[model samples]
Target: MSPLVIAGASRGVGLELARLARSGGRPVVALVRPGSDSSELRHLGVEVVAGDALSRADADRLFGSLPAGCDAVSTLSGLAGDGRRADDEGNINLVDAAAASGLTGRFLLITSIGCGEMAPYRSERAIAAFGAAVDAKTRAEEHLRGSGLAWTILRPGGLRTAPATGNGILSADPEMHGFINRADVAQLALRALRDPSTRDQAFAVVDRAEARSVNAIDPHPLLALGA
Candidate 1:
């Protein structure tokens, strides 16, 4: 299989996904910001490419040279720091570059629940604190949907630092909300990458016990990972 290229692998869901992919014996490459410490990613045997996803030139360089048929995943976000959110321009550039590369494999984007149709379900306070991020991610989601590449968008609910509970699941419902372990989300993402049935679909992901609804569009991938 072509290497799975992951952007924002310096930490959080992206780092966890890189760990899982390497553990599964899949070749991995990580695109992280310049000057960010990438010791962990390098330790995982991932080819660590130091580049800011926020730069269109950097994004283009990374995606343009990928081997044909390579899959990609992006967990880029700008919620924690200053300046423009990679959640918008960064993701858009990546999507555009991927489309330009003529890649035939899937491109998976890991966004969040407050985006798109689930916006109404977010608490007012939460929105007050993160409204800008939500909007940036929403724009990123829109760009990917129109990119023409085979793509899957996983909008994970509130993220948790807890270990994977094996209860995380994907729901087609627009109003689903809950907290899920980042590890579980990573597992689900890998499953989505391998399952062609999930292509061109955006699903809300959360732990079953915490979710308000259980209208999972596909049961197979959820159960495939022992969920």
Candidate 2:
């Protein structure tokens, strides 16, 4: 199995993805900003590379050194109150570097709902608070869509810190909206990586039980658990 390179692996879904990869016996490399705590990643035996995804030099250096068959995933997002966001340029750097690295494997990007064609379904409050982030992520998604890499984009709804409920699911429907735990999101992403049918498609992730409004949710065959 080829190693998986995960940017923004210091925490959140990125960290969880690294954990899942390691548990499945896949070698993993985590790119985290310098000075961010990475004790857990190291504990999982993931190679922790200090680099900012926002830096082209850093992205280039990390991806350029990886073997050709390596896969990549970016859960990079912007921080509140910061003018500089890894959500846009940072992810762009990753996509460009991966394309240049001869990465023959999949590149999964974890963007949020309300991006691209799903913009209208987003809540007004969310748009007001995270409008900039959403816009940035939208640009990142566009870049990856045209980057020519085997790509899968997952747009997750409101995130929760609770443990995995094993209820999260993928829906091609743009109207799906709800909350999903980080662990479940990580699990769904890994499943997508292993299933070729999900390539080049963007899915909205949500826990159906928690969904406030959901319809026409056609779960991919590989991801449907009937939960």
Instruction: Give every collision pair in model 1.
Output: none
Tens digits of per-residue lDDT, candidate 2, 162-221, equal 788888888888887888999999989888888888999998898868765556656666
TM-score for predicted model 2 compared with the true structure:
0.94
Model 1: per-residue Cα lDDT over 1-227, one tens digit each: 68999998889999999999999889998898888999999999999887887778888888777886999999998844667788898899899988888888899999998788888778889799988888899999999998899999899988998788988888778878788999999999998888767999989898888887545544335436333
lDDT to native, each model: 0.86, 0.88
Q: Which ten residues in a row have the lowest lDDT in candidate 2?
A: 218-227
* Superposition error at 118 for model 1 (Å): 1.4
C-alpha lDDT of residue 220 in model 2: 62
Considering every candidate listed, which one attains the maximal TM-score?
A: 2
